[model samples]
Target: MKDISRNDLLTKIQEVEFACLDLNLYLDTHPKDQKALMDFNMLAEEACRLRKIYEMKYGPLTNFGFSLAKYPFNWINDPWPWEYQ
Candidate 1:
């Protein structure tokens, strides 16, 4: 994987999520659109990938079960995910 900065990583996750949201809304109305469904799945995978990278580098994006916890409890660390500029 490329060495992406923290900000860039966050941006990627956000972008993918946005696209997925749009595709999901479309799918809700047009459930038979296989193309849109595929696109949404692909984007969802991308979002997961970017999120894993971010979490591994900095810390868990949230305190929930979405991410595994490391020693010292990274969630208590500085610079929360919403602190992005």
Candidate 2:
């Protein structure tokens, strides 16, 4: 795949994640939905790939050890909840 800006990749990840979640809820109601299950799997894989690409370049996208930290611990480097932009 071609290189994408961090913001673009993040957007893609969010979109895919949202689709996955929505599909998951649908599958919960319709347990025998093969098409939905397949779609969910595809979206899930894409989300993982996008997340790996993002974290590899921009450090962890999450905290509490869900993602690996590099040498300098950059989780605190990003803007905090109350920090101004």
Candidate 3:
């Protein structure tokens, strides 16, 4: 995969996160909306995929407790939000 600049990657990640959040809020009030659920699921999957890519290349953004002990996981070396754009 091409190496995206830190700023660009961060922006994309944030956008995906926001999209997921918006979908979640909608779902909260429309739990039985199948179409909305499907759209949310797709957006959520994309957000997760992007988040994983970002985390693998940079560091963990959430505190979901993932370890990389056997895979050179450097939790301490990961960038914090302020380190990004």
Candidate 4:
């Protein structure tokens, strides 16, 4: 797959996360729904993969954990998520 821009990747992650949450809520009342369960699992995996890619390319999404930065801790150099373009 072509490398997606940071913004696009973030958007993709957000969309997948939202889908996973919605499916989870549905499954809470209908636990036997195999189709919804499958979709939820797929979305959850996609969200995790997208997050790993984002962290590898940009930095950790958290403020102080699992972030590997350059010598000067350049994670601070990037715009905050709310300020993303």
| Highest TM-score scorer | 1
Model 4 lowest lDDT segment of ten: 63-72
RMSD of 2: 2.8
lDDT of 4 by residue, 1-85 (tens): 3479989988888888899889999999999999999889988988888888887777777666565556667667658655788
Candidate-wise lDDT, in order: 0.86, 0.81, 0.73, 0.81
Between prediction 2 and prediction 3, the one with superior TM-score is: 2
What lDDT tens digits, residue by residue, belong to model 1 across residues 3-79? 88888888888889999999999999999999999899989998888888888788898777878989987787777
Judging by lDDT against the true structure, name the best candidate: 1
| Per-residue accuracy of model 2 over 1-85 as CA lDDT, tens digit each | 4578767777778899899999999999998989989999999999999889878877777789789889877878855322312
The residue-level lDDT of candidate 1 at 35 comes to 92
Runs in model 2 deviating more than 4 A are 79-85
Off by over 4 Å in 4: 64-75
Stretches of model 3 off by over 4 angstroms after superposition: 1-3, 64-73
Q: Please write out the lDDT profile of model 3 over residues 1-85, one tens digit for every residue.
A: 3478767877887887798899899999999999989988888898777777777667677554652322555555635645755
Each model's TM-score?
0.92, 0.86, 0.75, 0.79
Higher-TM-score candidate of 1 and 3: 1
For model 4, the local distance difference test gives 0.81
